[model samples]
Target: MSDNLEDLKNNHQDFSKGSLDSNEEKNPYVLFGRWFDEAIASGELEVNACVISTVSVDLQPSARIVYLKEMVDNSFVFYTNYSSQKGKEIAINPKASMLFFWPKNERQVRIEGEVVKLPEAISDAYFESRPLQSKLGAWASHQSDELVDSSEIHNRMAYYSDKFGDVVPRPAHWGGYALMPQCIEFWQGRPSRLHDRIVFTSFEGTWKIHRKNP
Candidate 1:
């Protein structure tokens, strides 16, 4: 009751955490690794959490938060049910974008490119390593589908729990997708709204670096 909307609107914090120079590493993956490590060192929570935006076949854009599982061969990897909304969207249009923001460090990274399903072996390995309950949940939840009642999930979960016992196999519908970025832009917030934006775009087999207006 004591909070004032006017006071909140007037408050602003100028970013000065860090800067990205033009002479930095040319490989976006290497640069991402460095920033990721720095974020971890700075004690940022859930550093791998990122927003993935996918456009439906009808041109409707949807965004959701997903955890970055790994980076392999310069591709960002994450896992989910292939029957989900995002999965269906990707099937229709392989083009997608991912956004990572570390508010504590005043930094954000935006990547755009084509997404492809990862190898089944890799997905199986990661799936096997997950906790038992998660494996059961994966089997129980029919992602992005309508449920008649809330208890349906719990009922399916209990059923799968008893059926699997131990050593649950990864469902064929569940797997990982890798986003191979064509352009990656790193943004470092600066004072007075003059932020720094550096982008790396792929051309042929090489990457071209460029600076963009804030």
Candidate 2:
């Protein structure tokens, strides 16, 4: 392939697709829902995809993509193995952030919050709704654990399949997490590399909305 690094280094695209209205609805949740709906309408793939960032006890930060499953009482809910890297990090430090980007709309959302594990009942309900393979995989994979061989996981999967038969239950090590937002920032791309950012901060059980310099 030809060298494109130099070309890529100089390429730039001006963003002018949208701008956040200062007088728009101040409730972040309401605004998020509206933006999410618009993303869906605009045919953005994986509209519910979000990046979850967590920090280990050593202050090392890690980010991974997770699908937003639901919202519970204003918390963003997502599921994963409790033994995974992110899970363990959250256990050490509950402080986390989530990022939702919709390049198609020239918009992104940054959410800062503390995460808590969802109740087992909620996790069970979601697990029951998953496809059979997913439920089985949840039991087979020892998340975040070092594996000497790839085949070991498949072997474990086969064993779980044979053992559980047609009814696989959610593993005890897997569950849901709810991120309760303390600060939410909505960003809209504008021309001249200047963007619009609206921030909603929760204080004393109420949201304080304001604008931030881009």
Candidate 3:
């Protein structure tokens, strides 16, 4: 590879000028919602897309982009097939991280937490809320598994289409996951390179707040 390519690959995105003042009176959850609302108002694409990072039993790491569907009570929720790579990773190691960035607002949020499966009732409720086509696709796709041809998927969909023309039942393996945050960090970008970072952490029954250098 060229030296310029290597240098570019190693470069980091500099964020300057943002300040974090935890004096907002509201909790981190509320603050997050406020920022998210602003992001939506700013017309950012895929405001709900977040980077989910998981670790395997062998200590390897993997990550992917997934939609953030709900913020229930105090946790964030999303759904997927329980048999996928991420699913297996969480099965063995429940520690995970989620990152959200809104370029238009020059804001970023990072969450590190423990992963826990939502109650069956919650999962079932979200599953039932999905569109019939999504439900059918869920039943048709094997998720992270390999497929020999596109025909297999189409065939499966056809079979499901004939089997249930109007409505499709949610699969037991496809459901929702709740990520309970142990630490949450909010970042805002500034003019030069000095950015603001505020982090909130939970311990026992109390919460602690801190500021970190950019």
Candidate 4:
């Protein structure tokens, strides 16, 4: 290593939290649930947060952080404005990917799949569960759109608050999207930079598992 980067290059951590065995859970969802539970129990902040990537029709890629709300029908679920940049991109190209990293445990998961809109009833139910202010925000924010000033959002929030009074309805432009994953990969960090990687892919309604070099 160069002398200028010698100290930085020498800094490393020995990841000995856990290991991935071939005999472990075969279903990716099962494995994900186990790891997610452990993350929560370990006091990881924002454990449900993940980065989602989308590509527009022009082939430009964009990524943003979103919270994973639930796992339903073998898919990962999250909510957002249907008119947002990511939503528009997904409309043109349904293919998307999600990534979850837990630095404390030195683990990561990658999910790739096509996204689909959830039914209106499901969105309604989840919306009702949100706090009052958040419900108001859903109606106030014209997500991904240009705003003249921050005060515009406050004005809209005030308008919606007075209009809805106590019961705020979910906006027609807001709902949930489900990512039906075709491939899922799990990675575990280890000492000496020799990491463990396992990938599961879907084929003919069945999932096939494979180990990957890392």
Candidate 5:
């Protein structure tokens, strides 16, 4: 193992004690929102970042960091290139997992669920709200493709810049995916490596909350 890997393996972090009250159990979405609010208030770097994991048809898993754009109606929403590898993977198999870890709060949340394409109107509205540079870059770059040179990317940017000018339209190959979580597991740190784990699993129109072994 590398020196850094050895060092990381030997290192340990003790979690603070925090309990999720049982009475506060209506929706897991609300609990996640509350935890997200705390993470935001703690001022962690890129607090909105989440690790999205997707599996291909062959069951190979891939993960990438993506910024969480919104959580609406119990679904986590993030946008990316619909033609990217992840997009293609989801196209073939629409199941995905998401992880949110807040080092400062010693909290981690894992979610597993099915992915669904958002409405085109939702994508268009979000696309129009983006900064012009981002819009142009989105149109210019082909995600998950091999690039020969930086100059090619620059030329593509220039080409798109000239083609679309100021008002760049959202490409059909780019939009959002909403993960409808079937299970959400919340972890809180405690002393001596012992931790609190609470999981909510969705059933027929209801969620069953249970405590998990730490």
Candidate 6:
């Protein structure tokens, strides 16, 4: 046990990949776009993935990874089953936090904001673009529910496949939600633990920018 603890404590890496100056950029969304492009150029997997945290009615926090589908009107959008655990939490709380970590680039972005369902037309268009199998699977799986066995899901999948053929419609329970960020903070890793931090806070349609100590 002592050896394992010592090994864990010694496993450290110094970061010097990038730096961010709060004075250089006033728009968090613009900086986020550049960082996202660089991450894609670096050839990392799942660049759009982010961790979403939601609070239950009882104040318990739950977090899971979801893909960032789109950003429009200053809101980040993602799709999922409305019956999922996170969806239920959103129903009661109507707010969430999203974290994006690009380890290869030694950068992370934290966003906190209110969540609202996307317009039905947008969800319909996106759903129509999805592959036939994905549309079928969305109908087949009851998200966040206990499964009796693998066969149970497989049976459901087969049933949906036979029922929908090649033209599966989007289920009413599955759609997109947009997170309107009230605060966005960008972190760029630096050497000697002196990381750079810049935060943008929204107020009455204006953004107040500031820096934080590392």
What's the lDDT of the predicted structure labeled candidate 1? 0.94
lDDT of 6 at 20: 90
Candidate 5: tens digits of C-alpha lDDT, residues 1-214: 5898879967877777476655666678888889999998888789889999999888899999998897757799999999999999999999999999998888999999999999999989999999998998898889999988979888989999999999889999999999999999988888887788889999998998888888
Which 10 consecutive residues of model 5 have the lowest summed lDDT?
17-26
Per-prediction backbone clash count: 0, 0, 4, 0, 1, 0
Error of 1 at 181 (Å): 0.5
- Tens digit of per-residue lDDT, candidate 3, span 70-151: 9877998989998999999999899999999999888999999998988899888888888888988988999999998999
What TM-score, over all chains together, does every model reach?
0.95, 0.97, 0.90, 0.93, 0.94, 0.95
The 10 consecutive residues of candidate 2 with the worst lDDT sum are: 1-10
- Candidate maximizing TM-score: 2
- Residue pairs in clash, model 2: none
Question: Who wins the lDDT comparison?
Answer: 2
TM for candidate 5 is 0.94
**Model 1 CA deviation exceeding 4 Å by range:** 1-8
- Candidate 3 clashes: the total is 4
lDDT of 4 by residue, 106-200 (tens): 89999999999998999999999999999999999999999989999999999999999989999999999999999999999888778889999
- Pairs that collide, model 1: none
lDDT of model number 3:
0.88
lDDT of each: 0.94, 0.94, 0.88, 0.93, 0.89, 0.93
**Overall local distance difference test of candidate 4:** 0.93
Choose 5 or 6, whichever is better by TM-score.
6
For model 1, the run of ten residues with the poorest summed lDDT? 1-10
Tens digits of per-residue lDDT for model 6, 1-214: 5887879967878999989997878888898999999999988789999999999999999999999999978899999999999999999999899999998899999999999999999999999999888998899889998987989888999999998899898899999999999999999999999999999999888899998999
Off by over 4 Å in 2: none
Candidate 3 residues lying further than 4 Å off, grouped into runs, are: 1-18
